[model samples]
Target chain A: MTDASLNTASTQTGEAGFGDYFALLKPRVMTLVVFTALVGLLAAPVSVHPVVGFAAILFIAVGGGASGALNMWWDADIDAVMKRTARRPIPSGKVTGDEAFAIGMTLSAFAVVFLALATNWVAAGLLAFTIFFYVVIYSMWLKRWTPQNIVIGGAAGAFPPMIGWAAATGTVSIESVLMFALIFMWTPPHFWALALFMRSDYDEAGVPMLTVTHGRRATRVHILVYTILLAALAIGTGFTAVGGPIYLAVAVVLNVMFLIGAVRIWRRDEVMSEADNYAVEKKVFRLSLYYLFAHFGAIALEAGLAPFGFGGW
Target chain B: MSFRQEHELHKRRFGRNLGLGVILAGLVALVFGLTVVKVSNDDFSVETQASGGQN
Candidate 1:
């Protein structure tokens, strides 16, 4: 380990800034959590007051950030080893593990209690469960233990929309369950693609990613299988209440493009050079980002148009 | 930076974090206050009843 990695709460380097603390929140991931949660709230059958909706999304975002902070604290050692995550606040020596832990615990308590006050106990309960699953179940246990880590841990990411739905309706329904399933199915192909390109990072970090544990060929096959399953689920979701002409159109086009990318990835030979190998994987990873955003956007559009009788046949 | 300067910087950052905590606490208080007000108000109850009846 380098000196940077050795530095922790005992060592005093540069003073941490607000931005450093914010970085501990994993703002990029929080953005997805907030967006999906918003879609779930908006797309629900029940109508929530604008204030209530705003408050719920805010608390959900905070809860997601709290999870990120706790995950960073727990995984700082592995994070220091991974090139992709080396610059994170804790790993980079910008913040201490103790600071990250304190911030995470404080925010976790704040987000859960306030969410219960702002919305309902059901939503609060889901938020609390998401934090526990991410911090303890995924970060502490499954990540180091199994190659199927993301497969089970994906549930942590999948619960935001369900929490949002519960916040609005105070109940879980088929629509919210489908929303959860959509993300749950999409996560494997998404992360595995990144893992394929960044295999060395996981290897160095000693993370039991599928690519490290199962070999590239098996990972490729898994990606293809999961992508096909995801396509089926995504397209099937379009016929539900969350779907309409807009959502269905988006789903059909995106899933076809996604499947083609997955197939191209699966067909590539292991002997191919790094640049050529990564190009297809990178394209799939980029497409996966748009695939999610566009689907959620279409759902939001359907919800917006529902009152005009242009939504869900 | 000198040792004294670094110590001042640490103090400032601590103050900023404290400010952030206070602000967040205030937001929590505001949300709780609004929920209390809504619960006590007849208008909110009527709105809830209207929406419930529609359902």
Candidate 2:
């Protein structure tokens, strides 16, 4: 380290600002949580009081954030080794792991209690289970042990909409389940595509990602298979109660694009990928983000237009 | 001397305090709003309305 760098590090070590603490929440992940949950709430048959709806989404987001903090705390060791996560609060020494744990526990409890008060016990119960599944079942147990980690752990991310539906209607239904299925199936291909390009980070971090354990060829095939399955699910959802003409059109266009991308990924070898810096993988990863957002956005749009008699069939 | 040379540490501390203050204020407003909405809800007043003829 340079003298200037060392001096800066020394001065800033353990001197966390509010942003550092916020970073512990993994705000990017929370965005997906908040959006899905909002879509679920809006699409429900029952109308929620506006304040209660807002509070439900907020507490759900806080619960998601709390789980992220706990994941960072537990994964700090591997995070330090991975280039993608090396600059996280705990790994970078901006925040200690213990502090992260405390914040996570505190926020988790606060979110659950407040969500129950704002909506109902069913929503609160699902929120509490989501945090436990993400932190304990996924982060602590499955992540390091199996290449199937993302496949199962993805369920944790998929629960927000279900919880939101429960919050608004005080019950779970076929519509919410279909929404959950959409996200659940989309995650594997989305993450595996990322693993294709970020090849060394997971390897170095010793995580049993599909790319690291089953090899790149298998990972590619897995992506293709999952994308095909995901396409079927996404398109089929368009026929569900939560779906409509707008959602069907959006799903058709996006799924075709996603399938073509998956086929390209499956056809390319590592040599071809490396020759062009994994262009197809990178493109697919970018498309995955848009794919999910567009799908959910379409669902929300369908719900929004329903009152005007233009949303659903 | 009175200023004590105002370091980066103090600025960060101030920011943390300010952020906490805003979050607490937001929580208070949210709770108050929820109370008003819940109290004024038709469900909450249903019991009062049902007893009015009997009393």
Candidate 3:
């Protein structure tokens, strides 16, 4: 090979840009982490300094991103096999697995230590556990072993809001747990809907998704069951300290719509799904996103209005 | 005149280096701000001998 060609090849493969490293952090998931954690901080009864709150959220997001990097490193093999994750930094060859591992470890330590110094040890400890849970428990152990992987692994994603509340109050509370529960229960149905449409990806990767392990019919039933439970939790949260009139209204409307969507999903067979390209499933998935965002938004609204005498019941 | 073209790899490396530099600088600023906030808060006050005597 000519020097020019060698140089071209090296440029294409040898070094990754800033964006590639950022991609290793799974920025999309970080958005959810940041948002939920912010809501947790805001919804807390105790007031935190703006700077401290910002730093807490930043560290939580970094901790979350660190776990994402580790998850990508551990799952690089399956990620390559699955079309949905084939383009991830590790799988696409933009970043090396060792690099991902190193980054994950370094950032995990940095985030936890900095969080302890900035906020309280409780929040920092929770962040540490979240990273360990997502990487070691969820990614390494459960993901390949069980069809209920997403169900159990969802806990890692649910901890940020609780961590945020702890950052403010230095203790856990029912309100924070309710926020955590909202996400925890919502994760199964949200992911299952996506799995229904993208069944082949998990099957190809041998990930043992509910759809692949128990058939699509069973997966549909699981979706409906989880959604019903989630709806109950979402609406019930309306009466909690975190909930207010506005929150109740949002929860009622969204949960009703979510229930209708879930029922529709449960009733449809594979033939009906394929005929419409899983349109209903996709729509429900989209609504799930709105359902979560609106619920959290309502909580934030309640918190925002609290001092003004219009927020809580 | 002696001239050499910078490889594309060099540019990417430069960008990565710059990004890390910015992030490190931001961390320094954040730590500084946190220290200031902690020190200014009443809970963080150190009790001097005179203050302890007064109490």
Per-model TM values vs. the true structure: 0.89, 0.96, 0.95
Q: What share of the reference contacts is kept in model 3?
A: 0.86
In order of the candidates, what TM-score does chain B achieve? Answer: 0.67, 0.85, 0.75
Please tell me what DockQ candidate 2 reaches: 0.88
For each candidate, report its DockQ versus the true two-chain complex: 0.27, 0.88, 0.86
TM-score of 1: 0.89
Write the residue-wise lDDT of candidate 3 on A1-313 in tens digits.
5322332243234588999999999999999999999999999999999999999999999999999999999988777777677777776778888999999999999999999999999999999999999999999999999999999999999999999999999999999999999999999999999999997888877888999999999999999999999999999999999999999999999999999999999999999999999999999999999998999999999999999999988
Instruction: Give one digit per residue, the lDDT tens place, for model 1 in A1-313.
Output: 5533553442444688778888999999999999999999999988887777888999999999999999999998888777788789887787899999999999999999988988899999999999999999999999999999999999999999999999999999999999999999999999999998886889878899998898999999999999999999999999998998889999999999999999999998567627576888999999999999999999999998899978776
Model 2 whole-model lDDT (C-alpha atoms): 0.94
Best candidate, TM-score: 2
Candidate number with the higher TM-score (1 or 3): 3
Interface RMSD of each: 2.8, 0.6, 0.6
lDDT value, residue B28 of candidate 2: 100
Give the Å shift of residue A69 in candidate 1.
0.6
Per-residue CA lDDT of model 2 for A191-308, tens digit only, reads 9999999988899788999998999999999999999999999999998889999999999999999999999999999999999999999999999999999999999999999999
Docking quality band of candidate 2, CAPRI definitions:
high
- For model 3, how big is the iRMS in angstroms? 0.6
TM-score of chain A as modeled in candidate 3: 0.96
Best-first order by TM-score? 2, 3, 1
